[model samples]
Target: MAAVNVALAGRSYEVLVGSGLLGRVHCEAYSFLEPYGQRSIPVVADANAKRLLGEHLQASFRSAGLSIDWYEVPSGEASKSWAELEKLTDWLLDRGITRSDHVFALGGGVVGDLVGFACSILKRGCGFVQLPTTLLAQVDSSVGGKTAINASAGKNLIGAFHQPALVLADTACLASLPIREMRAGLAEVFKYGLLGDAEFFARVDADSNAILSHDNTVLESVITHCVGMKARIVAEDERETKDARALLNLGHTFGHALEAETGFSDTLLHGEAVALGMVLAARFSARRGLIAQSDAERVADALARAGLPTEIAALGLDCDGAALADHMRNDKKAEATTVPFILLRAIGEAYVARDVELADVGTFLDEQLRAH
Candidate 1:
């Protein structure tokens, strides 16, 4: 097992990465359950994950002299709603779960976001463990401490920064993921490279096949590398007061808008939207002469090589750039006049731009649509 520490002064925590890590949760991750030492773990999982690995987790905890209470919420973005949060809180209350208990979120990003948010507000704060099953969650969302719920206004409009006590990412669980989901996860993995690491991007360029084939060593390395990168950033800027943390949202501004326009439906998975968003951001940067057109092309080409969406045309969403921009106006990042965007000057270096001309945004969006 390899460990990366999220160094946040006193709130520091470890992210443990390896294959079959979930099965060894009792032995490997038991101590992180907070309130110092709590043996009873309330597991919150998506229904599908329960069918796949729930019993094993339950039995593992039970055998460790721990009482395990399992709760199920239907999977997907829709589950990250106020109604679901209220219901889950009520469920925990009925189960006699107190602020001292630890809740294990065992599934993809949705499970992590919801359960982590629930833990944040339950008695103002509680302990939770992230057992990320999807590569997207394992590498990014699961470790960041940014737990959120969707509001009618937009995605992740309601949430908090409640860090997980422990992150146990089991690479073996990824074997059961559908190819589409795996591809979606790769989009986020690719973002780490696009936002700030040319060498990391080069690594993915060379080993994309190994990652796709589920090579245990390669996949574990990928997850650990990405998680470590994220942990370093979050440790420095936990609340995003400075621009340091905002860089992580490189494609998220456009990506979140796409998700909002689609109503967070299956029409566009989060990672798929992020893939297209990164391409658009690169194109927009190129159009503004911030980066070479060749660089944008390279980004689009790399995404296509990974089997991820790289264009608006392929997404089947016929909205014009003006419409997409309208979605951006409502984005959380938008302020009185400018919406801060995480833009790339090159493959590995990204910066926040609050001065991008609105007309330039319109022109780029129109150009992207016309190309499709």
Candidate 2:
């Protein structure tokens, strides 16, 4: 087992990562839950993951003399809506969950975001644990303490900064994940490299196949590396008030817009949207002379090598630049007439640019869409 801590001052927590970690979660999460007394563990997982890993968690908790109630919701980004939030909260209330009880988020990013947010607002605040089962969640979302629900206005419009008491990322879950999902998860892992470490990007580029094939050693190393990066940044700026947390959102500005335009459909996975978004950022950075064209090409080439989408035109998205830019204007990062973008100066370095003009963004989007 490997562990990293998110040092959020008073709300610090540990992130445990390893293969078969799910089966051993009770022992791992017990210390966090101890602070809340004998409060029942409300396990929240997506339908698919509930069958795959939730049972083990439930049984483990039961065996440890801990009370647990399993709750399963349909999977996907759509599950982050208000309706689902209300439904899940109602279920929790019906089960008699109190402020002292801890909700265990036992799935991917969507499940973790929704459940964590639900716990945050329940009776003002309740404890929660994140058992991120997806590669994307394990390395990014689940570690950040930024729990949110999607509003009609945009993605993650309604949420809170309620950090989890613990985060358990089990590598065993990846063994059964579909290949496309695995590739999508790698997009976020790639984002870590693109946003911060050039050498990490090089490492991933070299071991892309090994990481995708669920090679145990490679998976552990990559997850640990990515989580360590996230933990350091999150510990420094938990609320994104400073620029520290924004670096983690390297491709999210464009990615969130793509998700909204697609209505958060399966047509474009978050990772797929992010893959294209990072390419867009790189291409635009190169166009603006912030980075060289060769750097942009290398970014695209790396994504393609990982089997991730690198071209917006190829996605068959119905919207053009104007439409996409409309979506961008509504992004949470938007301020007045500009959106904070993490533009790359090179393969491994990313910076937040708050002076981006929409006209330029529209022009770039138009060019990319035209190629499709």
Candidate 3:
């Protein structure tokens, strides 16, 4: 098992990455809960995850003399709404969950975000554990404390910074994930390299096959590396008050707009939109002479090779560049009238570009739309 510690002053936590972690729930849960003098846990999961490893987790916890109360919501982005949040909180209250109790989030990003947000506001803040079952959640969403639900205006517009008590990313869960979901997760894995480590990006280009094949060794190594990077950044800038942690949002500014345009539906998964957004960021950088045109093409080519979308034109949205740019105004990174964009000075070197004009962005996106 590979462990990364997110040393956030008083809210430090461990993120454990390994195979068969679900089977070891007894030991893991006991260690985490013992510190708080708890013997029972409330789990909030999606129906899909319940079908996969629910029994194993229940059996493991039960065997350790720990009781579990499980509540499952329907799968998908639609579940992260006010109505569902109300239902979940009502359920937690009926079950006697208090500020001192820890809630277990046992699914992918949707479940994690929803449950975490619920815990944050429930009784004015409670504890929660992240049991991320999907690749995207394991490497990205699970580690960060930025929990949120989708808002009518934009994605993650309503959220709080409530870090998890612990994150158990069991690689074994990936075996049951659909290929498309796995490919989507790889986009974030690639983003870690693109934003920080050039040599890691080269390794990903070379070992793309092994990574995609779900080779245990490669998966563990990749997840550990990504989690470690995020842990260090989170420790430094837990609330994103400094720009250190904002670098992690390299592809998110453009990506969130794409998600909004697609209505946060399966039409464009967050990871898929991010993969395409990174390409757009690279291309925009090239247009501004920040990077070579060949470098932008290389970034796009690598994502395409990994079976991810590299162009927005392919999404066939019925919107123009100005419309897409309008969606970005709601992004959390926006300050007053300007949005801070994480653009590349070079591969592995990302900086926040706050002077990017929305009109110029619309024109650049217009060119991209016309190309498709």
Candidates' lDDT values, in order? 0.85, 0.86, 0.89
For residue 337, model 1's alpha carbon misses the true position, in angstroms, by: 2.7
User: Considering TM-score, where higher is better, how would the candidates rank from best to worst?
Assistant: 3, 2, 1
For 192-288, candidate 1 gives per-residue lDDT tens digits of: 9988898999888778778878888989898889988898889788999889889989888888878987889988999999999999899888877
Q: How would the candidate models be sorted by lDDT, starting from the highest? A: 3, 2, 1
Residue lDDT tens for model 2, 1-372: 789988877887888889888777667877755654576767888988988776677777777777666788899999999999999999988978888777888889999999988998888998888888888888888987888988888898888988888888889888878889899999998898999899999899899999899998999999999999999998888889999989888888888888898889898999898998899999999999999999999999999999999888877778779788878777777888788888988888898898898878988898998774
> What ranges in model 1 sit over 4 Å off?
32-40
Top-scoring candidate (lDDT): 3
Between which residue pairs do clashes occur in model 1? Answer: none
Q: Tell me the deviation in Å of residue 59 in model 3.
A: 2.1
What is every candidate's alpha-carbon RMSD to the true fold? 1.8, 1.6, 1.5
Clashing pairs in 2: none
Angstrom error of the Cα, residue 144, model 2: value is 1.4
- How does each model score on TM-score? 0.96, 0.96, 0.97
List where candidate 3 sits over 4 angstroms from the true fold.
Answer: 32-40
